[model samples]
Target: MPSPRPDVHPPVVTGIGVASGLGHGKDAFRQGLFEGRSVFALLARPGRQRGDGSPPFFGVEMPDPPSILPPRVERTAGLSGRAAVAVLDEAWREAGLDRVAPERIGLIVGGTNLMAREQFLSLRDYAERLDFLPPRHGHVFLDTDICGLCASQFPIRGFAHTIGAASASGAAAIVAAAEAVSSGRVDACIALGALQDVSALDLQGFRALGALGAGPVCRPMDRGHDGFLYGEACAALVVTRPELAGGTIYGRVLGAGFCADGCRGPEPNSDGQVRAAQDALADAGLAAADIDYVNAHATGTPSGDDAELETLRRLNLGHARVNATKSIIGHGLSAAGAVEAAAVLIQMREGLLHPVLHLETPLDEGFGWVRGGMAEHRIRHALKFSFGFGGSNIALVFGAPEGAAA
Candidate 1:
C-alpha cells in the first residue's frame, strides 16, 4: 500500500554507529541500555575544577581516544570530531562503501556545540588562569562547521550542512538525509551529532538559565523531579537506498514529521509534541494504535516531563510501552535523537524494551513506562520523538524489517 504522505519513500539504513555517554559505538550502547545502567556521574572538567572559584560541572567521562584518524587530522579536531570520524569510518566499513566516490555521498551533522564550545571554554579558562592567549588555530573552527568539516575530511561532494534545531536537530538531519537518498540526489549519506564534554560555560549557562538540577541528578518522570543533568557524547548513522544494502536490517525509517509551537524559549509544550507525533503517524501510514513502543523525549525537567506525559496521555497509544533514554545517559543535546534512535533499533533487534530508568512515579494513570529489564514484544512499529527549544518538535517512525507485519 502506498503511504499517505507525499514525501514518504523507503530509505534504508545501511550502517549505524554511536559514541556517547553510554559508551563508544552501538554494541556498548545497547549493552549499557539493556542493563538499565546509569552513565551519569560527577561532571569532570580539570580546567573548570582548577579555575579559581569555578563550580564543578557533571558530565560523562570519555577515556582518551585510541588512534583512529591519521596523525594529520587527529591533532586538528576536538574529541567530538574524533568521535564523529570514528563513527563515520565505522559506518563506511560496515556499509562496504569505502570505495564509493565521495561526490556520490552527502554529509549532514547535527549539533548544538560543534567543537567550538570546548575550545572556547578551554581558551577562556586558560586565559583567566594564566593570562595566556590561544594559538592562531584555524582548526578551532573545525567543530563549529561540522557539515563543512566532515565533508572536507571525508571528501563528500553533495549536500552538506549542520542542523541546530535544538533537540530536533539530529532527527531533522535524518529526515534531510533520507530525502536526499529518496530523491536520488545521493546514493547514501552520513548523519552525525556530538556534544562535547561539559565545560564551565556549559554548566554555568544551563545553571543560569535554571535548567540544571541542584541535586546533580536527572530523574525523568519522577515525582521528585528537579532539573536535567547535562551530559555529552556523539553518534552517527549511515543511511542509504534500501534496495542497495545487505546485512542485518535493524529497522526501516518509515517517515518523519516536524512542527513548531512558535515558542520563544526553553519550555516544553505538549500541543506541539502531540502535533508532531500526529504528523509522523500520518506520514507513516499508521494509526496511533500501530505504535508498539515509544522512546520518549522525557528530559526530567518538571515541566518537560509533565508536558510529554500529558501529550502521550492525550494521544493515548495505550498498548505502546515507553522508555526514556535520557534517564540513563542524560540528554546529549543534538546527539539525543540519533542516540535514542540507535537505542530503539537495538531494542527491536534484541526483542527487548529498555526500561525508563528512575521513572517510579507515573505521571498519569494509563501511560505505561518500561520499568526494568527487557519487555519482550513483537514490536513492528515504534515512534521516537525529539523536541527542542523554540518549540521545534520532530517525530520519526521506524518499522520492522521488510516482509514483517505492520
Candidate 2:
C-alpha cells in the first residue's frame, strides 16, 4: 500500500440500481441480500436446456424486465437490452441527471456478446425461413446496440461506448466512468453491467471447461466448491463529483487499479491479483490496515477461490471483515462487479454486513468472516475485487461519504 495524493478528488457514487435473482430494484436487492435468501434452481428457459438430454444446469433466472420503452424500441431491444434500460432508469432518476446538461452526461456499458440467447433463439426460429427474420436483427446484434439504446432513452450526448473484459467488464466500466468525471470530460457518467443472456451453447462450453456446476447446490469458498452457477443480473451506478450531486451520496470512489497476467487462459494468477489490490490501496492513499471490509471475487471455482484467498493473505487484510456476494445471488459473470459494488454500498449505508450462504467448512480462518446472519459493522473503507478470464484483474476502493459517522 502507498500513500494517496491529497489533491486527488475522485468521483463519488450518488445513485445505484440493481436487478438480480434476489428481485428487481435497490430495495429488493438490499433486503434479500442481508436476509441471505437464494433463488437458484434448474434453469428452465427454452434455449438454456441441453439438446442431448442431459440434466439441466442450475442457475437463477430473473423475470422479464418491465415493458417501459416505446413499442418500436421494445420490439428491437431484446431481454438483455430491456434489462439494461430498466436498471439504468432507476439510477438516472435517483442521481437527478435529468437536471444536468444532456451533453455533460456520458454512458458506458460493460460486457460484449451480451445477447447470446436472443441471437440463438432468432437463428433457430428463422433457420428455414430467412425472409421472416426480424429486420432489426442487424441493429440489435451488435454489442454497441446496448450503448445506442441507452443513449436514445436518456439524454446522454457527451460520449458512449462499451467495454468487454470478460468477468471484469463491470469493474472496468466503473473505473472508466470515474476517470471520465475526474478528467472533466463529463459532469456525470453511468456505468452499466448489462445482463449476459447465456444460451445452451454457452452453458455447455463452460461445463466442458470445468467452470460451470451441474447442481443440487453451488457454494463458494466451501471445501466442496465445484463451479459457478450462472445468474442473470444487471446493475448501474451514477458517478459524479461531490459538488455536482445534490442528492444523497452513497460513497466515494477513492481509487482503482488494474493488471493483466499476459496469459490468455482461464487460470487464476495470484501475483496479478495481489498487485491489483496493492495498487488500489496505494491509489486510495491508504495502508492495508486502513481497510475495514473486502468484497471478494469468489466465484466458487476451486482454483479461483484459492487464488483470491491467497491474494488476501498476501495483502495482510486479516483485520477486515470479508464475505462473498455470489454466495447468495449466484455468479453474474459480467454484471458481478457492478452488482457486488452495489452490495458494498448498500451494506455500508445500512451498517450491516451480509452473510455468506452455505459456507459451512472454512477454507481459511485467519480473516474475519461474516457467516450465518447479518453482522452490524460500519464500513469506513472497503475494497472490491473483480477478476476475469484471460488474466484481467481489477480492484476498487470505496469509502463512506464525508461527514458520515463510523
Highest TM-score, which number?
Answer: 2
- Please provide, for model 2 over 44-105, each residue's C-alpha lDDT reduced to its tens digit, 9 standing for 90 to 100: 88899877878789989888788889998898788888999999999999999998999999
- lDDT of residue 102 for candidate 1: 77
Best by lDDT: 2
lDDT (CA) per prediction: 0.75, 0.89
In model 2, the runs with Cα more than 4 Å from the true position are: 1-7
Candidate 1, TM-score vs. the true structure? Answer: 0.91
Off by over 4 Å in 1: 1-9, 47-55, 125-136, 142-144, 152-155, 404-406
Pull out the clashing pairs in model 2: 4-285
The alpha-carbon deviation from the true structure for residue 261 of candidate 1, after best TM-score superposition, in angstroms, is: 1.0
Each model's TM-score? 0.91, 0.98
lDDT of 1 by residue, 1-406 (tens): 1236634447867788777676677777888888888776776645334366555565455555556877876666676777777777767677766656777788888766555456666676776665464452544555455565466667678777777788777787787787788878898887776655456666677778777775456778889777777667677777887777767567788877788899978888888888888888887788899898999988878888888888888888777888888888888787888878877877877788877777677666576678766677667899999988888988888887877544
How much is 303 displaced in model 1, in angstroms? 0.7
